[model samples]
Target chain A: MSTEVEIKSFIVRNFAPDVPPDQLEPDLNLLDSGVVDSLGLLRLIAWVGERFDIAVEEADISPDNFRSVDAIAAFVADARRNSEVAR
Target chain B: MRWNDDQQALHDAITELGDLLSENRAERDAAAVFPRANWDRVRATGLLGLPFPDRWGGLDQDLLTTMYVLEGLGHSCRDSGLSFSVSTHMVSVGVPLLRFGSAALKERYLPKVCDGSAIGAHAITEPDNGSDIMGMRTTAVRDGDEYVLTGGKTFVSNAPVADLFVVYARTGKAGSPNAITAFLVERDTPGLSVGTPIGKMGLRTSPFSEVSLDGCRVPATNRIGGEGAGFLVLDHVMKWEILCSFIINVGEMQHRLERCVEYATTREQFGQPIGSYQSVSNRIVDMKIAVETSRKWLYDTADKLQRGENVTTDIAIAKLTASEGNVSSALAAVQIFGGYGYTTEYGIEQGLRDAVGGTIYSGTSDVQRQRIARMLGI
Candidate 1:
């Protein structure tokens, strides 16, 4: 599965069960839409770290990074790239 | 993580100070008074700045090293309340400010926090909203260069003696993840008054009270993080709070276990040492298991956290295990000590009383379970 697809699936399954994966907009503001609360954000971050093999550091925990599916995927890709470059 | 010579030296330094810190602890606990003299001594040790940058007058130790020393503090200090206050002062304001504060803010306040000249506390829980941060009603409305804060916070650890507070108040709509904002409010800020220290079951020596912020105006620069970033700031702080605070509990449990073992073997009963019996020996064994388990969970979680892995579930489980284990270990120690434990002289009852707060503070055991369940997608 693609990064966006997997993220959408995880968010739908955990946070918005009523919303279908295909229907959940990639640009939907998860923070404002109340699709993800404070605890939900934590769950999302943890899932992202485990699923994407990215170590989400303290600096990367901004709301901007996790605001939408596309943003999260971008963050994951960027973090992976950075980790590889450092290695 | 094995500490090198320098880390061992720091840990040993604090361990040696325990004798002085614990002096008159029973009397202080009985009176429920903050030990000013001991607080001064703790300040001198620079333990408050264990995990902070050395540029800010801190010891510049890493998280694991800081926790390792804190565990030593718990093991050596008989006054659990004082140990609690020490941890609270560090994690409450210093942790957040170090992580999220601006460079100017760090330059101004980090020194005070590191030197322990200005004690720190954070106000998150309200009178009505205990564990529900999203339900917080304290609002901070932007007004020109200042944000006007009007709300009340309860159970603010170190409030009575605190010089600064990281107050979380609503900046947006309620129940929204981005609603709350964290502000660095000085204790002397107008309209901010701390209530008289409230009495509690345990951790009595660590003074906590209600903090009222009515139309208190704080400069925009005082905000710790970006507007609506209070939840994230708090999330980071809570992680440190659980690890730093509970590691002390781990230390306390280790001490309690040793005491129980010593008492069981030496204290004569029924014509032989009680430790020889399965019932008594079994309880001691369980206490031992609880100590090792709590230690393992705490350090393992810290290691994972240091590596920047997501620890939402790991932290909850660590908190639950350490907290619940502390409570059970204290109870078993009291039982093993028999009548001596029941009495106030040996401080066994006080240990049990102090242990109960572990289950409630930071996050309650129930809250931790809920967090873990949520992480499990339940």
Candidate 2:
């Protein structure tokens, strides 16, 4: 699956337990809606770190980056591009 | 933090220093001194090495053993500031280094930390924000093999006297939780200046201050974990901080309970002792429950954390329970002591003062509740 699909699946799996992954909004404001919290935010970043093989910089742990599935996908793409550049 | 006989002996040995500390506590509290003598006495007992590995001159004890011994310190030592300082000195640098530092970093720094020769502290909270750490303004920019840091950190527990600091600075874009990074910055590093100690209402003996990084240049090799692992490093330290720091609060509550009981039974009022009155007696009963309840949540959550279960919620509850419980128990002690409690001569007032900080530090009770609320998916 694509990064966006996979991330949406994670959101559905962890937060929208009763809803299917495809049903979860790709542009949902996870932070404003209380779908994720500070601790949940940390856990989500950690998951991103592990799943994407991108080490999360503390500065990168912002609500904007992980605001929604599209944002997460964008973050992953940027992180991958940055890592590749470093390589 | 389980303890064997050896740990028990260590606990007893450290507890004896309580008499030494209690002697000049009021004087030190009045002066707001760091109690260097008490610090040396604690160092002599080898208590500083409790949680470190034998290879690094540590006792190689587990989390529970460390908590058990620290709780003993809280029970015996009347100076809450000293206990707070000791816990900070242990977890501030040792924890991050032991967990995230490279072998070279550990080899060079862990021994000094374990020996107490090099005091350790971590810098995270900013003047603009206390709990909203991700919003801190400190920045670290990469420049070849070094990162030039610029920002200020306030309310640092051991910053005034710390020989080294685990400084957290933003290396990535703002609003990104993982954008910050941890760096081990030496006290003597040029452009890094520690402000004079700032006074406080409680934990006064443990001085805090602001640390300024004005174009402070630290080698990139000084970075801890990966470039963005500061949050993980801090999260790990906070878990240990809540477990170890508030466990001491539990000890203080226990000691306060016993002292209140002794005073209640012996100090007669009217035709009988104050203990005879349900109003007075009920308060003591509640204090007992508070102490036990704090202990239960502490160890139970610790056990879960040790088993590798996600205690993000459990720890918040435990921290909230222990911290707020300490304040509740201390207030009761003061009320039970009546006039004596209000007087500094009896030191009962200090108990309340010390307990107040428990609720504020290590993440406020309100913040803990928020964490629990978040875990509840609300």
Candidate 3:
């Protein structure tokens, strides 16, 4: 699956289980829509780290990076790129 | 991780202060009084500034090293309340401000926090909202260059003697993740009043009270993080709080375990050492297990946090294990010591009392379990 697809699936399965994964918009503004609460955000970050094998630093934990599916996918890609470059 | 000579030296220095800090602990605990002199002594040692930058009068120690030193404090100091207050002062205000406060805020307040000249506390739990921080009714409205805060916080550790507080109040819609905001409110701020210290079951010498913020005006620059970032700020602080505070408990448990072992081996029953009996020895064995388990969870979680990984579940599990383990270990020590442990003179009863507060504060055991369940997608 693509990064966006997997992120959407995970978000839907964990946060908005009732909604079909495909129905969840990529730019839905999860924070403003209340799709994810405080605890939910932490869980999402943990899942992102484990699923993508990325270390989400404290500085990367801004609302911009986790506002929606597209942003999270972009963050995962960027973190992976950075990790590779550092290696 | 192996500690270098400098880290070892720092840890030893704090451990050496145990004698002075533990002096008159029983009397202080009995009176439920904060040990002002001991606090001053701790301030003098620069132990309070562990894990902070040296530019701000800290030792520039890492998280693991900080925990290591705190473990020493716990093992050597008999006054659990004073130790509790020490951890509270560090993680409550210093940890959050250092991480999230603006450069101006850091420059203005970090020095005081590091030097221990100004004690720190945080106001998060309200009478109506303990576990559910999102449901907090305290509100902060933006007014010109200041934010007007109106709310009340309860069970605020170090409140009675705290010079600074990281107060979380709602800045947006109720129950929204982005609703709450953190403010660096001073104790002397107008309309901010701290109630008299309330009595507690354990950690009695720590001193906690209710904090009321009635139309308190705080400069916008005093905000710790961006608007609506209170949850994130608190998340970071709670991670530090659980690790830093519970590592002390780990040290205390180790000490309790040693004392139990000495008693079991030395105290004779029916002309034989009590430790020779399986019943008595089994409890001591469990205490050992609890100490090691709590230590492992605390350090492992701290290591993970320092690596900047997401530790939402790991932290919750660590907190649950350490807090519950400390409680059980204390009870087991009391049991192993028998009547002597029950007596106030031995101070074993005080250990059990102090351990109970670990489960209640920093999120109750039930709350930790619930957090784990949520992380598990339940």
True contacts kept of each: 0.65, 0.10, 0.51
Which model scores highest in DockQ?
Answer: 1
Query: How high is the lDDT of residue A43 in model 3?
Result: 85
Candidate 2 vs candidate 3: the TM-score winner is 3
Models ranked on lDDT: 1, 3, 2
Q: What is the lDDT of residue B208 in candidate 1?
A: 98
Interface RMSD per candidate (angstroms): 1.5, 7.0, 1.9
TM-score for chain A as predicted in candidate 3: 0.91
What is the per-residue lDDT of model 2 for residues B74-106, given as tens digits with 9 covering 90 to 100?
999999998998999899899889888899999
Docking class of 3: medium
> Which is the leading candidate under TM-score?
1
lDDT of 1 by residue, B1-378 (tens): 578999899999999998898888889999999998898999999998899999999999989999999999999999999999999999998999888899999999989998889999999999999989899999999999999999999999999999999999999878888788999999999989999999999999999999999999999999998998888889899999999999999999998888888888898888999999899999989999998998999999999889888788989999999999999999998889889999989999999999999999998999999999888888
When 1 and 2 are scored with lDDT, the better candidate is: 1
TM-score of each: 0.96, 0.87, 0.96
Instruction: Note the Cα lDDT for every prediction shown.
Output: 0.91, 0.85, 0.89
Ranking of predictions according to TM-score: 1, 3, 2
Instruction: List TM-score (chain A only) for every prediction.
Output: 0.92, 0.91, 0.91
User: Which has the higher DockQ value, candidate number 1 or candidate number 3?
Assistant: 1
| Prediction-by-prediction clash tally | 0, 23, 0
Error of 3 at B373 (Å): 1.6
